[model samples]
Target chain A: MKWLPRILGAAMLAGAAGVGIATALEAPAGDPQVVELLSGLNYVPSQSNIDVVLGEGAVEDLIEIAEDSSIDSDPGLRIRAFRSLGQYDGNPQRATAASALRRAIADYGAESSGTKLLYLRASMLSLAAIDGGNAVSNLVTMLGHPSRDIRAACAQALGITGVAAAIQPLRARDLIEPEEQVRLAIADALFLLGSKG
Target chain B: MSVLAATAAMLSLYLASGLACGGAGAGAPCQSHSECDDSYQCLAQVCSPKCTRNSDCGDGFQCNEAGVCNRVFANLGDPCGSEWDCEIGQSCVLEHGDSNDDQKLESSCQEQGEGGRVGSTCIADDDCRDSLCSLGHCSQLCRITDDCPDGNRCESIPRVLGVDDSAFFAGCIEDTSVLSTTIAMSESSGTLRIPVPSSAESFAIVAEVSDKIHLVGVTRVDSPSDFLLFRESDSFEGFLANPIRYARSKEVSTLIFPSNGVQEIEPGVYDVEIEASLPPFGPGTAVPKVSVHYKLRDSHILDLTFYFLNLEDHPCKESMGIDNLDKSSAKNSDVFQDEYLGEIHNIFGYANIVFPEEPEYVNLKRERPDLDGITDEQDLRDLFRLADNEDGLAIFFVRSLPSDGVQTLGTTIPGPPRTPGGPSSGIVVALDSLCYRSWTTLARITAHSMAGQMGLWNNRDPHGITDPIGDSDSSTGNLMYFGEFGGTELSEGQRRVLSLYPGLR
Candidate 1:
């Protein structure tokens, strides 16, 4: 009975269906207020404290939902939280979300599951949504990661960034990247960036 | 009784009592209007003779337009002249902009399609195919965002994966512009009992409900009396994740028999019980329920060949024992025949090939990656070269993959007829050393590779970076879903796609 509400609450929080709640019992570890907010909804929440959380500088709390690996969080909630952070309009909180994304990419490794990889990739895209000033340089640095997925994520981030600065690095990465998917991502990034310029 | 006399008496009774009589007149029994004879058809579920056409009935009655003898206001989609003409599910609307008689604004009952076909234009979700009308056009299926039609972006096709995790590759759906007022409603329901054929190689069941609160499951136990065993620790989610334990498909509502290396069961009274929990319905609100059951009859069996390769210098090799070849071959083949594809294909009679020299062995792993640890394109072609004349699927068991679990779990050669990879489609699986064997892993890999080769796409996210079907965020118990080894069954869409395979011919 409690499971239904927990699932419904998490699903609404994430705006997705059956993302990653079925594998384990515990919700994603995060700030106590955020956790309480998520756990209290026994039924679908028609309204929430999202605006309050965002306005009261709960960007870090949202990031915790995105970053917490103790329990597998639904990608929708993390991505949504990240997007909200990107659009927060405040410089410091926005920067915090961007930095969290960077740390996630920097720490991404072989142990990452496909789902975790998706969360990280979405995180990078969140940075692009904000037009994060240093996203181009940060993504360019990520192009050298050993894992093809991270490099591809970086390429996608750069494409979404549509920054002129990413063009040269993307072209260079496109030339040397061995993985077909990563190479394609780099090509797409180059096209998007070039088109924007 | 004469028609006038009967009609007058029925009219008199109707006027006096304002109620219907079930056994009134010649008609002895009746339920709803639909069950009554032409003479008696109305909402009262009575035996009173009702008009066949509008003209026959008096002031209050008008013939129902669907050709039903009963007379009532227009139902959904019926032609209407006024506001009162339409029924509960219908609305009256104008057909033309002109006011003149030639092109006058004559209206008819208008209702949305609710589930139109792809490429068709629609004003609402109901007008679109699959109730997924978005951006004025019915949604298209896609692998990537680019595959979708213009002005439409891909959205997840829900409930096709499993309850625990999502399978992204159940195929991409377009985002609908129309917000559905009703959360979940399909076009069917009831206590449907499906008969299992004696010759069935395998069977799979899929249950998809609208809300997370609705619990849908399938079991083969004697009755729901054994439901407790299936509902472990009071956690429905946990129980759903492990359906195979309680004779249910894991996560998804699917089941395949002769499972876990067991022999086929004899034909008997196997009772398959389905469970669905209904939520509280609001008063006066009509809620539609959805339940679908499919039984694949006239089974078809496909041939399977297992080619075991060994390196002369390498310590890893297949061990032979008393009936080892037959037993292992049957076990491996069962994964295809009974576990996943059994309902559609009866995979049987596996042929094994052993290479004594290391050169051919080396060539297989190195040919494309070719023979070293994985099946390169060349490895697949070479293995199939010695397969049975009619054998369409070949699984090459190599001594070892260079990187073990990291590199050589299993791989499928993308083939012609769908994607242009090679002349044929097959799998190159790297199993554990002869002593430390795991059948589940091999079966899992084979299931993944075979599905790919058979033209089944991996249900990955739109970005297409995930590995295997499990990675796709599908919540259904589909074999193509990631996270689990064996699948409950191939989804209906998957079955339709795989039906076109040359091997199934």
Candidate 2:
């Protein structure tokens, strides 16, 4: 499971290259099937359909589309890519995604304006999905961040990680956590960790 | 702690007992009043001087009306922390309408000198100057809507004191209005489509079913992409046998395409394809499912009355007496109503239980040792006796119910129960003791009753089969989710399903 993300990422990239050719040969770009496939790259892909597209070797294309500067320019499209990228469980290829998302996170922070909460949130979620040692450590560090959303996102990611090591840190954080919503996130994270164990 | 002790620990708050066997301490342990030395009677197992009058206690202390010597902690207009911090029987209330104080009280203990006027917040009747606390508000008691303040009407809400103890409190609350629309096969409206014109800013859908049938609907959005969003009603035989197609939506006709989108969204096309089908009816099985979609644009309301039934030797009812229950249940109901209002829809109407004299029916489970805690034939028979719903939902609060945990907090008949005579009406009998559980659990159980009444099924994952309607990918955060914990919301599908029932009509 620890190695799952990298393996899946590689498989996704290789399979995506083949799928990109196959899909183009099979149907025109605007086809409903194509639309559905492209919709997977859209901000909120259906969970059930996610596996289907990833299995069809569309993961690589999803990555490419997500990374494209033109698409990244659009908040909706960029967030969608980040979101899809975040769903990658254990793919080494996620390093590229992680870096891209990190930049987005940094850019959003630098701008320090507008309604890029969703973008930052999506990036954070992707970072959680593209699990690496750095992702885990960064998320844990976010537990004390000043932003409520960031703290909440970090708590949520830790829970999704299902890492037992997070339990103690979460419990310790909870003692000092002021916000009710953040406390709820930490409690939920603890429950998930305990349940996983 | 013994199992009994643990149960008691979870039951209620108690002043400390066995206080180091010391003297002078207010609630110190003692076998007799003489052990207190300071003259305190052993009331509620605590040694203290019992008094019939205020003159009995010396300076700095007064004999409370309850004949207990309590410190004269604070007086009206005096700053205090809690009611306990004030003189016994005197309530510490938050001073309202002091706008200059940053909406914060500088802290004061005011005498509950007057009866509760309309709109004042209260916990118990004693807190109200008028001696009436209804629905957590200092209600202006009234017999008719005219008696209430302007824009507020009198409602007959139940004063639930205990499982078997209830009384009616006719108090004024804001009036709830429901805008109803019908979903049926008519000559002009053939092919089964409900036009949710963009104009209706907010609304709720309420549908009803009298038989086993598939209620299907397609949410059409007028976006450039015709994303075919499809959902269907659960079948009657499996986990999907629930009638809830959707919970209340945040907005009118907001369809969440789980495949895409952020937050609840109204479809580009304000059109929905609806289809209702029943199993081939051959012998006495043809009940046309009547569905009314109330587009409660801004008024998302579903009213339900809880009838607390008294039964012989029922553990919950017998243990938690009416007065204690009234406070706890009222507090819980207030939270439940507020939760619904905050997350999904507004449950209108009343939040009281009718406590009728005489046991509705003997709880047969107490007599039959072999019956376990699962709700069986006799249980349903007893429950239906108290279910007096001509229409709309009914929550029959009871004492002992079947338990998989400490006790079964809630149980609902998914559809009409099958009997020798045939299937009749069903009831959602929740345990009277549910008031003791966390507010989250109480809310979940109450939501369960509404789901049952609306014909929504439980999320039957432990039972093996996952009903798509009941257990959807969007089940998380949904009120109908399979857990007793966590935040809850109404899914678009759930809202649509709930709208099929004439919940308000």
Candidate 3:
């Protein structure tokens, strides 16, 4: 009976070592590829090509890069990661991406207003592409954001969603929107929605 | 008394007699109110009785605020019977019709206003008084060529306003003035508060940092900061710490004010702070030079010089057919030139394209490997430095670009004005895409990049955010639409913005 227990412990130790080796092999291969692709996603023309390289773990990788606020993390890279997440619009794992985007939007900490704005803009577009009708209410709520750029981005995202529910919220915001640029965005959104209908 | 004085006295007496006798009835022609009956008024050179509403005035007339019937003036270029029947500064003139027969002659309001009277330069409509600051000078509104000064013609120019599609006005413009000034920079990183004269309509500032010194950012001094009008950067916070409108490029940083409709840069002394940093490979200290191109007057022609870089040794040359391109001389063949020119003409009817020089073949790839695939921002900057056309936009056509979806068809967002051989000198277009096989696509891409360089933002950015221009929509047909292809039409607002580009001679 004592010899049987010793044999079981030895088997368990071997299993743990195998798992560790598998993780080490996977991390090195996967991380660098993801980082390379993420770095290329900053501008418009290269975005589509990089999306092809993104794999099953891409959503989680993007979430990690987007949420990384460590001293070593590049703010521009994080913003790009947030934007790249939108490329997974039809993926089953998009809900997870959307949730990560939502958390990024809600968690306003030590980041500058401009940085926060960049995050919010990237999140709104991704949410619109990923969630569509489900993202309408959240987008509608952001229409009242204090920043003119944010409000305008939200209005535009609402239009991009192509959801009928977005139209009412946009119209309501149109009445009270004081900023001229925001008003123009709302009008454009309304026009887009009307055309969609 | 002299004969002229006696005649004038008699005419006044006759006019007094006419008024004393309740002279002309309604609808009768009269030069003055004295010729009309008492309680009636002479309006539009016609004797008319007091009226309460437009109905009482009959067709082609409206009751005036003064309780008199007045002839309704026709719009600009509309047919009219008399000067009185047309708007102020407009006159009825008869011209032979297309048939060239006396009987076929038609009369229309030929003169709209005395145009080309004010030669003062202006940047915006608010800069002029009672006249429009169009094409860099105060121009008089006109309906026909007859209203303009000698050598000037009434042109229907696009108007920059948040209005409908038919937003155009006729103005008198003939010549343009392009001027440049050089400011010697004492240091690599310092603020130069250049005094922009009130006479300068639109100006472009080009800062040429030493080869070792990379331009960090160019900030136009302003309160509360409007930094990075074209593209945002992570380093924006540092620039925004001091209130300014910040712009950044590679070796050469160009700042074009009123770059788009969203920005309305008035004519005043602008403090431009040029910031540069020494890259790891660069020298410790460098002297930068700043060149300012001031468009004192407006011009219709957009001069362009196309640089076809020789990609004979490029890695992708054989695959992309770069080796087949004629490298002996500038590819000035009529086949591609005519197509390129035709596309530009079709998009901008008012804009004329002038090739300053035959397209030159530059063996730049032999010197720089980075030119092969412009994947890095520095590579694009290096490619732009190969341009040598200062009087016009320098468009560099390369063999290939990074196939990564993020690779730009054109590198510069809004290319620097009047600068040559610098990072922001001009736009770099990659000819690698299968899309470039169609000359129409290539032309559209060129036109789009030119419009962007000329200060027009995308109708809608990739983030789904629309431009500040109200008239520009998300229509795929709009030339300024964010997509790389399909869009060909330019909105009136966009045309108006493009007219402000300093490169237009």
Candidate 4:
């Protein structure tokens, strides 16, 4: 009869462990069917459980580690956190706190065909932010990203930001960025801002 | 070593249909992780800790990410270098950005590929944050766009503005994240687009390594009735390589194209096609079924994507392009001509059931209500329906599907198209093709130069719209300018075609 208490304690512990797994199972389920689920976009278990999913170091984080600019730089953990934040895009509260879309772009970029897709989700909160209307300040950081795609994408975002004052600055310096694509992208941004070519 | 003894070979195979092993370093003469012992998880066939000597990484590979051994997964068509590799059906080619010997963190296929998400830009792994091959791209996480950042639209470059993050730099109408990218070779407008060959429409047979030609477009045709535009002597890295049409321009596209000024090129896979005739200036129309020469270059170096013309965007068939594939039957080879007939390309080559993705005729029949593009099985239906209905239309369709997205030709296929997977669209597009060559060659010439296929195919090759418009300003007597999508200035070759057949368009 005394064993019952110990069994109860063990049961509680088991339940505690299952809570984490249950969150994961429910969280975007992380790309089931032999596919690696990206962290921070979908199936993050849940917001409450996001920490746990990230605790295990997700797939997207590994990609960051693999692609970082600084040789031998391990950006995996940082990416995991950012990806977790990105998953919040579906939720407004999450979007405001982490701006999952911006977090992702800030971390990675949309230079290639595949990356451009991230914009689909980013468009959501991006529009929301624009609606809230502090866009120019929001995009300022993105303008400096090393990737031209990101810069170009950010320029697009600035166009979405819709703040009129941004046109002059966008046109003045015009992203004297190194890459031609960046220059073209900045040119595109200015054009989007309705800057006279 | 003691590590082997201490860990006592564990037999952990996930036995499904075939033995699925977790692998404990017990395999021999293996090549990649897919070749390990029944119970071994081989990274590079080492059967222990996922790598043999460093060379086991194949070429352009390095070990990283918890000893998970990374390797480059593309090289010609058969480019998978790992066990968990994205084969023909899998959109898993890692898009490493341009490598700079000066930069330590430049793109390297050395490790696992860039399996990231769509819309995410990447300079290094730091950007991806969470490595998932999303939207046909590999990336870390959404960085700059408000999708992941604060409420911001169009951010300026922070470093220049003392704000050092993605928000200050990039912007767009939509939020975005970059996975990985290469240098944009040609201008987005393709101003440097070179002209077609001198005798682009004619047929020429030459046997010199330096024989020169220019490619206008390429379509993979099983029938041997088109043009032969590629040469064998130059263009390829290896002998016995498939022929490719060479593009002549002032600058090189990748390392693929030769030096500028001299249009002369070597042999390799090229999309552009050219025909030769001893009478290079055109005017001869006496021939019936003249065999023009061409080549299909291996543009595998191009980055791949998973997301493509979403149903909601543009003239997507599933969206508004075609309300439903109600199986319409029309008269003659086209609306105007009556020479030959064409049907769907059959994917129902049952004996050729090479990949899981290749759809069955039955499956296609079920999806007819929502079908937009053609599958192998649907292709067969096209032919069957054509012959069955006697529509007598040469149903020439072109698609810019990536080799790894749908069923792969030349080699065994992997599977059918997985929407929102592996650059759901093909990068190697058969652009600016025509159902009836002679009927639409002029418009097609204009379209091909613009990089968009205006063909009335089952599916539209968006790459047909590869170029931007507003090239010149007006389609003048001699030259045509960009018109919002693409710009085309009549080159020497094109001028020759126009002069030879006045009022062709």
Candidate 5:
């Protein structure tokens, strides 16, 4: 199926060669979806694309999957694509948000590498805490990471999470940990989690 | 009947929680007066004002002008008369300067699905003690120090996994909050059968129940007749009459019924997937507990008549002319525990292919659940004769030893567990199967069945295998696979026997 990269019919994939690189800029290299998307970038895709490209089942599945971290089982564009979907409203959306975020955090941990990986993991964990209701467990564990940014982020998140349990961890860290600023943040987070441990 | 009246009579609606609630999805709205899942508290003793957090309430919810906690959402500014309007995370506070109706909870929305013993997070094993977070279930139990209830002891529950092994239940030998409960499911399909006390609510699901949702809705699409739920009828005996307390479409939301919130039962006939978030509202929930009962059925071998005995000489008389009824040599098999076919008990399989004189007309219909209107003596005889070619046909007689399935019963809990993974399968039998093509086998079987040839489908799980006959046997040694090169590792005699039959064209 390798053809010259053509965007919207004008040969965006013209440079596409064998099992290697892709010069197509509209999408990432080596991704057939990107190549296909490029080919039709010019052609007016019928509204059927709505149902075909982003079918209802796909949307719902994306929603269901995007909310959880385990769904990152598929290690490719599809996983990242689903994680980027939005949420529902009312009590229903409220209910699905919690574990979905927990899953997202878990999935991010498996995907990331190096220093930036910690940043991404921390960001995702923070995002999970906000989406899910007062999650002290995840937030507290996030504090255990080697990265100070992640620990600080988790400490801050733990405060707003509103679980009284978060206070003990923050206080525990304050007494034992040598880092003064981290201890200070823990003390403040304890105050926010609704208990000054 | 009025909704309330209908709900009251079906009294099971009061069955709170998991043992009953079926599947529900996301993004559906609900009036505070109507609720789903007992997790949401019914303030004022009636269904109203669900407060997951203080932020859900507009402005801020806290201890409002009234003592009840109020709730509020973020960024909408302070707009509330009481604190009860706040959400779970928010705390309603009174304005220091203003005394007139300024009661508001200033707090962020609380996190959802956390802060609990089982489903929530815990720093130490003690916090998670009361809950089991194994195998994707989040229920409270005390199996070990790791699975103990908060402040409880961990002891093994007697015969928890099965009769042979002692599964520990971690809890104080003298602990409280550990409740003993039981639930069951229908045995065969068609007529629902279960054994839950109509009154025991707040119990856990027993392991045996499968494909069982809280409420079961059976509708006859073709027939104009309205579907009826009964308990026990002559034609439709033991049907559920108004099986669900209340039934509704998208319009009619919650039904009014005094809910007890718990039920326990052993085994009996009941509805499937009928429990709803609303009391007896029936069917359709966010989390669906659906089970499936897969079966392969056949008909009764009603009449056995000896037609032609090739004792002297017959078509099946190979080269020489003879037949020996005594040397038929067949051994009755029982539960010998074959590694391949699970534990089969009392299996007697008889297959007969009818042969006729000078190409007589022949036909066959798989006789099972439905034999149609022709249930009389003459009709039954006629059907069998056509199937066996008026008089007799080619056939084989086979029987198997009796065997049991699943080593022991599994740990069955109601509702999705807070703890996701746990080991709870009672039936553990070693099986020697083709692992690589298992999925392909399933797909092929599915395709054949869907194409309306289910009667001819071959089950990968075989009857028995002391190792398929070796090099000399049929190549594939697939008795079920009729027209194929002999299965691998079959006996030469077996292959010769297969060669005697015509191959699949």
Candidate 6:
């Protein structure tokens, strides 16, 4: 009976190692220091340092935290993650970060409208920063969001992208935007783009 | 013959004798030299006396090349060469006009009356009658208290633009009145209207919420659709988007109407709405509280409490060692007070700082491991809770902050007024970075952070966004510039926003 109990304990240890191996194969591990810095509040490390420390795992880790929908996750951390992704403006992984942020627009869910709005705003900003030309279409769709704040934020994000394609959609939205604030935002975007040209 | 008729006949006879009329003297209003007394010439609609130099003409009159003492209009906006050339307002400000021609912009007398009356709202100098608009009002220029209207005081204005010493001026500003109240949150979400009195020229609302509430929004009751929204999980972007309306932390928020004193804020009812989460234990839980501090008028006295944090065991302690302030020495030392407090006073002439008690040596590191570095919001909230002081602003001095580049200094943007032990508790200054610099530099950093907490934006942000205050220009010398250290000059509009802080008494 003692031998049988020992064998069962060994079996449990082996299963745990197998699970760890599976996770390692799925994604590269992030440096503990990088994780600690990112998890903390107030200070954000520079993008160059993050890339040097985490290498290719940087974008994957950020995307995972940003897309996390669990109730236990801190909403503030998710927002920070989105912003950090935006710092990778010139990196090759920026495209991947942008795609993840775009997906987060639909995947991220919260009970409170305030939380949802904040997440959407962060995603919009990061997307524009990462790939302005590609982000134009996604931002254009959010111009029709039910919340006026979201629509206004979308228009502002479109202007920040500085892509020529954003100008036409913003001008088109200008005529149809119902809210005064949103309409003003659309007009500002058009003006910004027009000035850039 | 009545007495009036006899007096009129004598005056007519005197005028007919060819002797200059003796009724009007120098500086008196006159239509012609014949209406002035002997030896006095009528110039620019006023009687002027014969003179060789400016000194012989007396004050408010300058000797012209024609050897006559000419009356100086020297009202606000009138061009002038020196203070002596101006009237009661001693300031002869050197202005750079809008004309591309460089010579058109020159020194002009700084006084008030062309745009609007005293106490009227204004956007720029051109909008006021006085040619000098300060704190959204047409403030009269003055050389002394006697020059100001009753109930107002003549205060020195900080020179924010150029280095010219002649540009110095003083303005008349009113004192402040602060009112505080608490609103009980009865439900998950609801709106409450706070009445604003007609006497209020400008107002600020600071709301400190309980743990349960996660969001708050403020707006004029008449215009509910365009409200300022503040969430518990706000980031730097949130604060930047609504600089005067949002706080960095969740437990506290602020909303300043006409933040830069440029916009017109109507005196009426303002609506505040809060959204809270239900207590896990269910309905019988204690109701959440939202403390509100409403301030009216501008120009105030602020109290400060410095907490010297003990970072003996801090992981990121500066290599040079922490310079822990001696509590008793700091309180009694005149040099220490003059270094920082004097700089603040220089920038905001009406702002007075008083230390209610000796500085406290606090050991926040014992409460939390990461407190020595303050890397996150929870850590800051914990530190503030441990060193909570409701009497005034609580400034925590730490060894170092775990940040990159310019973020070594951390503070709540627009701190909650009169609230203690919350997320927006106080300010944290990294002594490591400031130890080697002069105390005046420390004062600049402190003043900049304090102004931010009190409700002021940088003159210009990275996105090329300027503050709503029309008087504030983007210059490195400005106290509200984005840089960590520089000049300590504060614009009149910046002072208005600083005075609106609820913590100011």
- Model number with the top lDDT: 3
In candidate 5, which residue ranges exceed 4 Å CA deviation? A1-97, A104-112, A115-134, A177-197, B1-505
Q: Taking the tens digit of each residue's C-alpha lDDT, what string does model 3 give over A92-170?
A: 7789998987786677422323455566767887788788888887777788877655676688789888878999999
The digit string of per-residue lDDT tens for model 4 on B9-59 reads 322222222333443344332456565644444543345445433223333
Q: What's the lDDT for candidate 6?
A: 0.55
Docking class of 3: incorrect
Q: Write the number of the candidate with greater TM-score, choosing between 1 and 3.
A: 3
For candidate 2, the iRMS in Å is 25.7
Question: What lDDT tens digits, residue by residue, belong to model 1 across residues B259-368?
Answer: 22222333222334455544343111222232221112322233445555433222222322112222234344433223322321211111011111111111232232
Q: How far is B37's C-alpha from truth in model 5 (Å)? A: 99
**lDDT by residue (tens digit), candidate 2, A17-113:** 4211110111113323323333211015543455565564545655555555552233333445567777565555666667776766666543221
lDDT of 6 by residue, B432-475 (tens): 43323345556666766777777777776433467767787876
Q: Residue-wise lDDT of candidate 5 within B120-212, one digit each (tens)? A: 433322333222332122333322343232443333221112111122222222232212222222322232222122122211222221222
DockQ result, candidate 5: 0.01
Q: Clashing residue pairs, candidate 6?
A: A41-B376, B112-B130, B113-B129, B113-B130, B114-B129, B114-B130, B115-B128, B115-B129, B116-B129
Instruction: Give the Å error, residue B247, model 1.
Output: 34
lDDT scores for all predictions? 0.41, 0.42, 0.56, 0.27, 0.27, 0.55
What is the per-residue lDDT of model 3 for residues B38-81, given as tens digits with 9 covering 90 to 100? 76676655565666654344434545677676656677668653
Report clashes for each candidate as comma-separated counts: 45, 54, 10, 205, 169, 9
Question: What is candidate 2's lDDT per residue for B341-379, written digit by digit as tens?
Answer: 111121111111111111122223233222222134444
Ranked by DockQ, the better of candidates 5 and 6 is 6
- 3 or 6, greater by lDDT: 3
lDDT of candidate 6 at residue A10, scale 0 to 100: 38
Evaluate chain B of model 3: give its TM-score. Answer: 0.53
TM-score versus the correct structure, for each prediction: 0.28, 0.29, 0.44, 0.21, 0.19, 0.43
Candidate scoring better on DockQ of 2 and 6: 6
